[model samples]
Target chain A: MTTATTTDLYPTRGTAEVLTPRQDPVVWGAPGTTGPLRPSELGDFDRDGFLPVDALIGPEDVARYHAELERLCADPAVRADERSIVEAKSRDIRSVFEVHKISPVFAELVRDPRVVDRARQILGSDVYVHQSRINVKPGFGASGFYWHSDFETWHAEDGLPRMRAVSVSIALTENHDTNGGLMIMPGSHRTFLGCAGATPEDNYKKSLQMQDAGTPSHTALTELAGRHGIRLFTGQPGSAVWFDCNCMHGSGDNITPYPRSNVFIVFNSVENAAVEPFAAPVRRPEFIGARDFTPVR
Target chain B: MTTATTTDLYPTRGTAEVLTPRQDPVVWGAPGTTGPLRPSELGDFDRDGFLPVDALIGPEDVARYHAELERLCADPAVRADERSIVEAKSRDIRSVFEVHKISPVFAELVRDPRVVDRARQILGSDVYVHQSRINVKPGFGASGFYWHSDFETWHAEDGLPRMRAVSVSIALTENHDTNGGLMIMPGSHRTFLGCAGATPEDNYKKSLQMQDAGTPSHTALTELAGRHGIRLFTGQPGSAVWFDCNCMHGSGDNITPYPRSNVFIVFNSVENAAVEPFAAPVRRPEFIGARDFTPVR
Candidate 1:
């Protein structure tokens, strides 16, 4: 293992308050890396598997991040990597994955206190964003998603150890039905549901030796919705949603003339961080996730 | 056109109460075929894409329907249809599609007053179960679905005219996270969202004529969920969630040892009933949907 020196102590994406640099590097569960949660919020989170921090982020930060998203997406150099830039049915820019590795603004967004404090409270330890992305459903014809769970992807694709992580979705626009908003089943974190999808043992191989996971069938969606009942989350520009990784969730298409955008950061407990996919000995790519296990204050 | 005969007036599905034989054949939109909704409920339905009728169904009805779901799924005849029986990675039963056409109990579920009454109020006319199914995420290995908008399928494949329809998810048992509960983005009914999925115009010809609509990418889901947030529906047996046809939704897999079962019914306004898919002269198969336009009260 490499020694933690002052020069290379904090592998921070940027100067976001969520990842404050410590005088000394520490592993998870170390002191000064976390804060206490409000009793009521913790209770609700434990019971509901989700919580909302309404308007916790300031307007300036939201504007800055939104601008940065647009700037990065427009840069041709950023779009060179197929994995970083994804397209919708209309061929519009849909999402920018792994932005924390390329842009300081996005890196800072990952470490925001509004997200980290709650995540730590949920995981009860230090955390890192295993996956970070910005979903941009711009104007009309931005495609919607089918129903599936994130753990299904994390466990099947990344070999994540457990369902101990949380996902934070930070809204950059008015999230409404017309703009491809999110829908979730509450209290869904209590259990891990099985799934239907491709399971390639060597997906991350240089040759991409695995097939992609197929979407859940229509019959499966119809049945789950019947028993659980579904709900939507429409918040103003600066609100944030904290959800359990095991919760079953999905979103609609943005066929409206308006645009919908947000930054999504998936935080896994350092204790529960995944190794390489399919039991591989080497670590996964840094763009997907890093092997650095230092706790972020 | 052939005159409506008393013997075959309804083109009924079994002997369900909703399709009770009538001495005289009445056209769709006739009075007495639909009931009124409370003004408050109507307002809520207009504002929010969905509304829940809590305990509207009695315990006896719930039990009866649940039992029928189990009985029908196990029968070889019902499972014979490849489209009806779906499997997950774990190879357990995931869903039972087109239930209304196969079982009397499910046929009655199509016209459950709790569902039809409000549906007519929202639709402002008679309605029909264009599609009905039972999503069976049974205990271990029950698969979940990906996020998607249902109208994307209907409009592109079934020649549906508009979004003048609703889906009722009737809980046959307790719907929780472990069992792959239904989740939604609230108020997603305000506008029609574009989607990525199989476009079947060419599918019917065996030439692979049309490209399948792409699945919602990871970025798209993250953006929408951030803006709108998401919520789950967990209710006791017999409670139902009535949702807009265009809502973005999906569910989780059930790894737990508990089964999550529910019947799903999609009601389309008689005036808004679909024509042949993609403007084709021939109709889609019955197992997919019905061409019988006889209205149900």
Candidate 2:
């Protein structure tokens, strides 16, 4: 069983007592309600480092959470806070953080049984929210993020210990053609796409042309695209995608009138918790890099 | 030059790249307005493992925060959630968490300049809130606590790497002798009081009489108590106490007619952030053991 272990890289710790109380695998739902996903369901994730989640929130819950997301995004502070970004032309909220901290409804979404129960099955034992945000693509030429893997930034910038983490993106609105849906190269996670310099101020713009000599060269990613094949993650509202942190992925700009908003949450194994980041001198604010590591019950 | 490094245990890290980008000493405030404290100011924290702040939150701010605390105590969900506890006879609120996630007022307190600046200086960089609670000791014979160190609970249960953490308790009401104020051993943090069982359901009580074989024995603690005299932390409204997470400490019951309420927050160095607990199968819920490690700016 893969577990969160300690790194011996640093030299000053006093004792082995530092790594105590190993976590136990948690059973999900009632015996029959939902044990775990079928092998077929996780096949893609096992091979490609990501999986698709269907009907996670259902219609009613999706509506509720979507409304909450909108309300939180409307809050001026969300935009003012460093975590929020705008789609220049549309002037709409592009991303927001600690939504669970602001709205009681969003807080409920963070604890939704549908999400929590499944996450436990995949990661084993209890899982704590490493990071939570709503990536909003305001339509009619709204921005789309370019190719990048989360772990590259997470490990380098946020200090996440290992790749024992995955992200769940619950589409608040339909993400279809013309709206710039997510795209990933099957099995690209196996390759370590080295990154250079910290992700520039904003993620969407900088990610596209940010690579350097040591980073993922366009030539290499192009080869993987031809060999492994690229897949599109387009779905209806309430549908979700769970991707490994190491998977190289990105999306194109949206020119459709329809907007695409998805609540993205990164869940890390309690065993694989993070330390201080190794990437740069300045770290992102709490709105960006979470500080609390308590597991969700 | 003391910095937060890694624990020596757990041997499976894949790379030396696991640890990178050492933490820098963050400047607390504008140049010269009020710089870091002098060596003498932190003499107690360095020598005795604790420091006392005479007036952190001003009377006006304390009044405001105290009002917010009472309002939250009345929240139905707050009472229903496992985090809140009552003193039995007094029926007063004992503890609560995610207060910053709920109330905007409490959220502001989480970012209070006074609390953040000093914590950064001591921690040597940006710091994040590890745990936050309101401990209430209602008068007329309200309950008091026994002795124990925070790191004992944090390390054994929460997987914190080092004791690079501190607790700030700001008195909302006057903490007097009759009210069963906090009592702590002067320099107990230097020694590690290993614990076995998980920290009990509630901190206010179990802390008073909790410990077993694998943990530090009472007989051993008694000897230390004799050598290092215990000091009572009693003060007026707005006064605060900053103590090392490893310091042996606890408080007493309040038999007086007066009541004592305080806002207690735990701050850990960003570089020394935590992972999921390692102690056992089940773990503390998000309310009790937070997972977010975002440093407060």
Candidate 3:
């Protein structure tokens, strides 16, 4: 029997108190939970550091979210003020959670059994919600955001959770390769740093390449995304794509007239963890809807 | 005349939208916003691919957030349930924006003018709130989280916004060397896909003889943080640290009795370009409270 030892390769906190509550029944003792992550998934995660779990959300939900988003955008209540306004033409759509509670579809997407189970198998206890939000992109020429990473922000020396924290994006519209669908760099997430927090000039200097210069015509991955199997996740409404938070991804332009919308949520284990809120606060209606929620540590 | 066509580099659609409304504002108009970024800040960002802005959360605000966190943790009504629980002993928290709305202190911290201005300087136009959350690590014996970049979980594209996003962490308490302050591989962010996101087992197989077993060490900037006057920000309450999301970073054990806490936020410009959310979402009450705020494209 593998006796629990402090010096074991996987040195755990030993006490049950140190363990995080299991959110997915599949990994824990809860019934109807799935089996352990497949070797293929593990191998992908190990080699690429992430994998995309498909069909997380469906089409019907996407339509609903888009409609609700349109309503929110039209509402005069969601105006940008001086203090809250961070951009020139950007109308601050403060907190969507206040104006709208997560649709049941959104909540279902978050509480997906397969995802929770997979997280449990990889992360092991102490899993917690890192953040969730809805980003609605309207038509207009905005300067493209620079590339960057999520982990670079919350730098910590102790109490960081093991395994990849999962970030799930639910498309509320039919995203196509041309109409601002999500694009990724395949294995680049495990290789390239993806310009987290650096300026374009700095990136140019460091990489010796200009931002618009485009990936070198010689690069294999660029060629692959361009010619061969460049996987573009153009999902129907409500179709969700779940990936590791560190994955390298960017959105295509809304070249089409329709607005591109999506809801995102990230989750991490809570055990032996030290996490703080990373953004400004938003309001949540107290409908006793989602009961027994834990507080941020 | 410097028409749009003449400008080689332009802002993203989201960024452009944000800037469109403020094109007349002196701060963002002409020379002020058009000039190149500061050398040192740019260097820091270039070398590490990111920089940390200070006082992301004021000292007093940190104190209040701590208090509210304590109340939420202690509240019996917020206990984890069967489905939601992840770790048995560790409890997960959610929806902090609700509490933040009531506390003017947190509002001020989130909208800290200085931090926002710096962010604008670094990442032009409107900054999108990628995520926000407070993490508390109770002394659990879980192995320290693996060493990896945040963007590794997403796609592998080299030019994705994962490269441009900046994360800011406001230390709520004094993080000492012993108590597990953040450890970073200085300048590691600039390496050409060096040994980052490597498996722990692979890293172990390649560990340096002089290094301690199982303790991960980065190669690029390891020696720089301590040598040549390179300072490690042993972050104190009210002080914030920012770095490239791709910068090599990890945490140590929280051997102390008290928990480690901090407020972290990731920002990106939303313009004509699009990128998926990398991490989980924590609530932003300030976004909900501030009406008439323009949504940063």
- lDDT winner among the candidates? 2
Docking class of 3: incorrect
In the range A66-136, model 2's lDDT, one tens digit per residue, is 88788778888777876666655566777776666656777678788778766776676578888888888
How far is A15's C-alpha from truth in model 2 (Å)?
64
Models 1 onward score TM values of: 0.53, 0.43, 0.34
Cα shift from native, residue B151, model 3 (Å): 2.4
Please write out the lDDT profile of model 3 over residues B77-110, one tens digit for every residue.
5333211112223434322332233345544555
By TM-score, is 1 or 3 better?
A: 1
Instruction: Chain B TM-score per candidate, please.
Output: 0.78, 0.82, 0.58
Q: Which segments of candidate 1 are over 4 A away from where they belong?
A: A1-52, A81-101, A107-170, A173-236, A240-279, A287-297, B1-52, B82-101, B107-169, B173-236, B241-278, B286-297
Candidate 2, residues B9-80, lDDT tens digits: the string is: 321112221212112222222333343455665665767877888998899999999999888888898888
Candidate 1 residues B1-297, lDDT tens each? 899432222221122212121222112233344455566665566566677778768899998988898887777776776546556355444566677777877787777676777677677788887888887777534545556666655654566666677788888888753356776766554434444333444443331111134234455556665666666677888888888776667664453345788888888889877764532334556556656666776
RMSD of 3: 25.9
Candidates ranked, most accurate by DockQ first: 1, 3, 2
Best by DockQ: 1
lDDT of 3 by residue, A62-162 (tens): 56667766665556654331111122245434224322233454455455565455665555453545555566654321112222233322211122223
> For model 2, what is the alpha-carbon lDDT of residue A210?
30
